[model samples]
Target chain A: MNIEIKDLRFTYPTGLEALKGISLSVNAGEQVAIVGQNGAGKTTLVRHFNGLLRPSAGSVWIGDWDTSKYSVAKLASRVGYVFQNPDEQLFSRDVLTEVAFGPKNLGYEKDKVDALVKRALSLTELNDQTETNPYDLSPTWRKMVALASIIAMDTPIVIFDEPTTGQDAVNVARIANVIAELKKEGKTVITITHDIDFCAENFERVIALSKGEVLLDGPAREVLGQEEILAQTYVDPPQLTRLGKMLGLKATVINQEEFLNALK
Target chain B: MAFVNFQNVTYKYPLTKTPVLKNINLQVNEGEFIAVMGPNGAGKSTLCYALAGFVPHFFKGEISGEIEVDGKKSSESTLDEWVLNVGLAFQNPFNQISGAKYTVFEEIAFGLENIGVPRNEMKDRVDEAMALTGIRDLADRSPYSLSGGQQQRVALTSILVMRPRLLVLDEPTSQMDPIGTREVFGVVRKMAEEGMTVVMVEHKVEWIAHFADRVIALNEGQVLMEGKPNEVLTADLLPEKGFGISRYTSVARQAQQQGLWKQKQLPVTLFEAAEGFTSKGGGGSN
Candidate 1:
């Protein structure tokens, strides 16, 4: 299902305007990455998709359902929002229970919930830790469990908040693969992230936000390849892009692997 | 004398029988930038806490052998005294800060004020600390209002204002984005340049290798190797230590695989790697 936002404006209880007159649309099965500096209203914008935050003005529509009219629990089945801190989202003792929470809440039968939990656990590669207490696991494992929980909910629109924050290269690669799988399963993936390398590698389109406005939106390579625009958004473009600009090479190389291949 | 010393130290948790750190003897001189790197649960954070005198003080455990900071035995000193000599920043920034209503300025001043620094000297010290961490503008802002990067800076400035002789940071940039990571490391490198001893437990070896005076690798609670960045970041050794080499370093390795760059030295940064590639003219599209 496609998502449409029309003139969305949000103001906090303290009279602070977080998002102002924003409008955008994300198509079905489109992998779009939202890039911005700190306090750029990235989080505020994504929260609207899942009805976690109702806009003060304008409207957010997921297909025919108006997000403002739907309850969080009702919207959650259609839009899965995974928070940045897994500790904030995961409260169950074991991975199985954590994954099952979402499916059960969606009114799935007990047998179906159990099957969905098992499937989600296997997808996140946490099958071996099904019985382990979440607190006893590492931060990365906890994050995977959180992702499994959302997967068990089986939302068509999945949003990830900085999924690669503290991950190492291997774990990052694993998350990237998971994202790829999400795309293969015909899910619309919207990610708020600052890992420019990961964005350049995995995402096809990019939207750059600054001071509660959409500054740029285009192909990930074009958006992230511009050093001045990236610097303006408080983003450090991938190193290879900098190297490319410094050497007067074509402004297309974004990673070392691509740079090496281009050199060849 | 070394500012911090761990001599054949071994430690185990209360209920667990296995040792978390084993036969580790290391010395950190005053005003040095040292990075401790390893995979998950490699006892790096354990070493940081032990050096900060948290093993027996904050955590219940059995520790053997000697660990000292500034010639004072770690077990003998109180946490308050340890705070004076060595300031520690945890991997999670949320757990480090205190005072819900405290602004960034007030948070930094809390430690200095507790130590009974003169009221007249507090403002200047706080300003300097804020300036050092590039959070001077954030002094008036609430700690909760800042971004992850800005919040981490506030936490760092709070520790830096204490002017501890040694600073122990556990993955200070783990919770930050790429730009934020660069900013934090820039502050850390500047601190080391200004003659502050910095021991960081980090996983991003590429960023650390550029500024670290020494690199120590740990595995399963034991020191696997310790040396210069080039010596420790070698392709043959890093993979064995369970570290995925930096992409720049990996590219250089692949170039060597294809008989391009003939140099044996590993390039840790994009600048260095690019220079190496260009100077060799072996794979320079430019």
Candidate 2:
């Protein structure tokens, strides 16, 4: 399903304009990343897809459905949101129950729910901890549990908010694999990240937001190469990309292979 | 004796059978900046709590061996007395906020006020600390109203004002942007230069390579490797152990294997990587 936003504007109850006159679209199965400083309105903009926060002006459409007109639960079948803080979303006694909660809530048949939960648990490597209470797990493990819950829901459009925060390298690699798997299944993946390297490695499209407006949006190669513009939003290009620039490499490189190829 | 020493230290949380930190032996000289890197469940945060005197002191469990700071053993000092000279800022910035204070400035000053520092001296210290973290403009804002990055800065400022002999930070800049992260690293590096011992648990490999004096790699409740930042961060063992190393290191390693990289040592920073891949006459291509 495609996501279309037209001049979307949002204001908090406290009178802060979180997003202003933003317009963009993600075609079906496109992998996109959003990067910016803390108050750059990344979260506020993505929250529109699930109808968590309605736009103050303008419109948001997920597929043919107007997001503002659909209930969050109704939209859950299409959009799976993985929050930054796992603590905010996790409330189940055990990992199995937690992973099952999403698909079951969507009213999937028991057989399908079990299969989805099993796949999610395996992908997140939570099979061993299925009997363990989520709270009993470390913050790192809890993050995986939260991810598993959303994966079990199996939405066509998935949004990950700072998925790498507080995760170790191993868990980060695990999460990246899950994302790759999602892309293989032709799911549209949108991530808001501070880890530029992770974004560069995973997403093809990059969107930079600054002070409630889009600063730069294009292919990761072109957009991330604009170091000065990304700096305006307090972001930096991936390490390999920066190194390529410093070495006077003609091509913009975002990953190790491209960088090695450039060096050659 | 070293300023901070851990001798055969092993600890288990209450009701937990296996020890989170096991048989650790370490030493840190005064003013040294040490960065700890490890996978999850590797006991990095537990090490921070132990350094800040939280392990056996607050989170009591089966513990042995001495945790000594500044020639004083942890067993001999109360948690209150220990924290006075060994300030700590951990993973959750939200928990560090003192709810009694209405503004960021007052919240930072709350620690000094409790110790009865004169009002004038307290104000100066709070202002200076906030300036160090570049959060001086947030002085009047409520702590709860700030963004996560802002809150992290406030938390760090709150601890820096105490001017402890030993500083323990657990992923203090986890939520910060690239610029915010650089600023915080600069502040901590400055603090170390002024003769403060810092033990930080951080995952950003490039910053650790640039600023930290030493690197300690932990895995499964033990010290897997310890050395200078360049050595530890570029070591093949780090990647095998599931530790996140710099992309520069990863790239350079692959390049070296293919005989494309000429440098004997892998690069942990972008500058080093650029220099390594560049030819002798200032060009960087095959």
Instruction: Name the lDDT of candidate 2.
Output: 0.91
Give a tens-digit lDDT track for model 1, residues A1-264: 999999999987756687988999899999999988877888889999999899999999998999999999999989998888788798998888888999999999999898888878888899899899898787878889988999888889999998887776667778898899889999999999877778888999999988788988988888888778877878877766766666567648877677767766
- Fnat, 2 decimals, each candidate: 0.40, 0.82
iRMSD of all candidate structures: 2.3, 1.7
lDDT of each: 0.83, 0.91
The candidate maximizing TM-score is: 2
Poorest 10 consecutive residues of model 2 chain B by lDDT?
B277-286
Q: Report, to 2 decimal places, the DockQ of model 1.
A: 0.53
In terms of lDDT, model 1 sits at 0.83
The TM-score obtained by model 2 is: 0.96
- Local error of candidate 2 at residue B241 (angstroms): 1.3
What would the per-residue lDDT of candidate 2 be over residues A63-129, giving only the tens digit for each residue?
Answer: 9999989999999999999998788899989899999999999999999999999999999999899
Could you tell me which residue pairs clash in candidate 1?
Answer: none
